[model samples]
Target: MADYDLEALSLGELKKMQKDVAKAIATFEDRQKAEARAKVEAFARDLGYSLPELFGTETKSTRAPAAAKYRHPENPSLTWSGRGRKPQWFVEALAAGKTASDLAIS
Candidate 1:
């Protein structure tokens, strides 16, 4: 990380620095998603929801729905399972252009 010359920074420069800081924070958040998924999965398991019963992405459908119901591959029981405070491998997979049907439920 480069040191910011705080004394030399103008208002515009400060705004640019703020934007850069925001970008860095967003990047760190993206990287932490895997850790978040693991935490959610563990919590879901403790709460008595079998992962497979919730996510149910194992079966392949020839005529899959254009927008199938999203589930967390990690916890699966989460209400907003796609992406949010909680993240899932299945959601990440779909984002990477792989269908949910391609991943085996474990």
Candidate 2:
């Protein structure tokens, strides 16, 4: 709430102020999140359900494992889920005049 002449502050003073501001912001955000979580948990309890029961536990894996979509022709064991970056072998195969469809597991 206090007004600050930030432009007039020295470099060292500004850096210190920046650090203090960052810490304050982090603390404020944490406090706000905790308060919100408490309110949600209380409402869930009132509805005859625990917080985790209402909103599934964070420890549980939310996504199913990705299935293998592509496989190396020379070696059936070499497989790719086709999610992220293409593997080096896949790139080499493509460079050797092989179409992407040629690597399809199905």
Best model number under TM-score? 2
- In terms of lDDT, the poorest run of 10 residues in model 2 is 52-61
Check candidate 1 and list the clashing pairs. Answer: none
Reference-based TM-score, model 2: 0.55
- For each candidate, what TM-score against the reference? 0.33, 0.55
Runs with alpha carbons beyond 4 Å of true place in candidate 1:
34-54, 58-106
Q: Which pairs clash in model 2?
A: none
- Candidate 2 global CA lDDT score: 0.93
Count clashing residue pairs per candidate.
0, 0
Cα lDDT tens digits, model 2, 1-106, are 8999988999999999999989999999999999999999899889999977877886966799899999999999999999999999999999999999999988
